[model samples]
Target: MIQSVRQTFNQAFSPEHYRAFLDKINADFPGQLDFRVAETPVFVPKVLTDKLLTACNDIVNVITRSDFKTLTEQAIPEGQRVPNEDDHTQFMAVDFAVCTDESGELTPQLIELQGFPSLYGFQPYLADQFRANYPIPENLSHLFSVANNAEYLERLRQMVVGDCNPEEVILLEIYPEQQKTRIDFTLTEKFLGVAAVCLTKIKKEGRALYYEKDGRTIRIRRIYNRLIFDDLQHYPDLKTDFYLTDDVDVEWIGHPNWFFRISKYTLPLLKSPYIPASYFLSDLTDYPADLENYVLKPLFSFAGSGVKLHITSTDLDAIPSEQRSGYLLQRKVTYEPVIQSPDGLVKSEIRMLFIWPKEDERPTLLTNLSRLSRGEMIGVNFNKNKDWVGGTVCFFEQ
Candidate 1:
């Protein structure tokens, strides 16, 4: 973090200015902002930024290996495997917690990585709003590998829409309008021509998928998939003509199989200085002596679901022997309260977004989103009735 810039921004900050910033975001897309926006954007110094980039490269090396998929063949759960997976995942988000090393120097430690799409559409809009409402430095930028907002969106369009007509590509999700992150869906439709279509809404005739739009049947040639199989469990009774596991005749921009292959299940396989020690609960013959420093995580859950920060032998033994393979024991990284908030210091996590086009040798790191937390963990339930803790973007020193 840049102390000088943080001091300057905090000194200039006012309650009225923060309200106006929120007003502008709401006015841009009415009622689309379902989550709180942090009062300020993080100013990341070059030292931490360089370290974060290096950590990402280390993880990329493992993911891009020739036998990466073959090694992770068991990651996919039975009866949940999706057909027609792409050669690689189109999107990836690697998370890092701002931590202090034994030397008391600020550093980043790898928290988790996901081979799924993040807030790719709404992040640039949030960055522009931050700039419009505050005095962000000219040298600081939230974008990577791109010059401006237009360039960023253009690159995203190329990956999502590709050679196919924008209208032919659909952002597939399960009742996307009701989802909390619907604002990104709205922005995705506004920036790109693709609209979010519900799974039940899709009509299937043989291997072809179609959806009714404006009273006309439109063929779906490609899908920018936003649906997760875990979310589908809540709607077991809901009937649909097309199943995700069914071999369909459409191209998948972000394949569903990659989501399972590159999730918490892949954490133990990764080795990096930034990455903490991790092991599948089933494979651990002996528990570590310092069990308090480790956390138990369900391999398939998202958004911090089913994660126990405090661990004990009883907790580990309570898990059925047959079901232990579905869990992970990850050493918890100490999140230093580095970001200076008006009330007090807050812990932060930076999620680096990336895009890996089929032709590219590896994934390209693009803009990032940072979450400020004043509670036990970073999530809606933990940070309720809290200030300066929610969704926000990060502006790094160029």
Candidate 2:
């Protein structure tokens, strides 16, 4: 983290400015934000930025390798490949932690990587609002490239949907109104002119999926899928005519299989200074002596549902041998409370956004999302009742 910029922002910060910022946001989209917008932004320095990009390349090398399919098949489910798919994912996000190395220099460690979609619309829009209200320095930019928020989002849209009309592509989620990330869905619809259709709302006829918008039927050709099968299991009674596992004519903007394949399971295989030590439960020949220094995480669980922070032997023994294969033990990296708060320092985590264009050769870092926390963990529940700790983003040099 950049200490000078962090100190300057906090010293010059005003409650009135934040209130104006919120008012501007609500005026644009009323009732869109909850009480979480008042938190501080995560300031990422150049050193951590460079390290994160380097760590990403290390993982990308593995993903694009010749034996990558074989390596991925070690954990990925069989018979799930999209028969004859070629270059479908147009967006990718790799999250990293700003951690201190043995030499005490702040460096990035890879936490997780995904070839999936992110909050492309809201982040850039929010950045502009931040710049308007806050006293952001001339050198610091909310965007990664020379392109502004609109240009970047349009580029992403062109990469994902191509020449297809925006009306034909729908951002599909499972009961989006009930989702925690409904704000992102709404923002995406506003930017892309696509509706956020619930999975249950989709009607299947033959091999095509369609959804009704304003009582008019619209054929869904490209699906920007945000549904996770793990979450779908929660609502057993919910019915859907369109199924992901079924062979459908719809082209996926972010393929579903990659979510399961490149998630926490890949953490163990990735070697980087920015990534902490991770190991699959089944593959460990000997137990680590410092077991308390690690956290037990289910490879496929979303959010933090099945994570055990204070890990114990009894907890591991309780799981059946077959089920143990689905879990992993990740070394706990202390999130340094570097950002100065009114009371004390706050901890932060950076979510890096990337766009993999079909016409381009590699993934580009476009935008970012960050979270500031005062508690041990970075989630809302963990830092409840704490100040200056919630959803935020970084403004870096363009």
Model 1 spans with C-alpha error above 4 angstroms: none
Q: How many pairs of residues collide in model 1?
A: 0
Q: What is the total number of backbone clashes in candidate 2? A: 5
Per-residue alpha-carbon lDDT of candidate 2 for residues 1-398, written as tens digits (9 for 90 to 100): 56787777787787776777778888987766663764466667777677767887887766666665556665555544543244534677787766788788777766667766777777877777777776677677667764677688787778667788888998888878776677777788887777788888889899888999888998988888787777778888887897777778877777787776667877877777677899988887676889999899988777677788898877887888888888999998777767787778777778888776655666677888887877767778888887687777887643
Candidate 2 backbone collisions, by pair: 108-274, 109-274, 109-275, 110-274, 110-275
lDDT tens digits, residues 1-398, model 1?
A: 79988998898899899998999989989988898889999999998899899999999999999999998999999998988887899999999999988898888998888999999999999999988878889899999999998999999999999988888999999999888889999999999988999999998998999999999899999999999988999997989999999998999999999998999988988888899999999999999999999999999898899999998999999999999999999999989998998888999999999999989999999899999999888888999998889999999996
Evaluate residue 101 in candidate 2 and report its C-alpha lDDT on the 0 to 100 scale.
Answer: 80
**TM-score, each model?**
0.99, 0.93
Candidate 1, residue 294: lDDT: 97
List ranges where model 2 is wrong by over 4 Å: 74-88
* Residues forming the 10-long window of minimal summed lDDT in candidate 1: 79-88
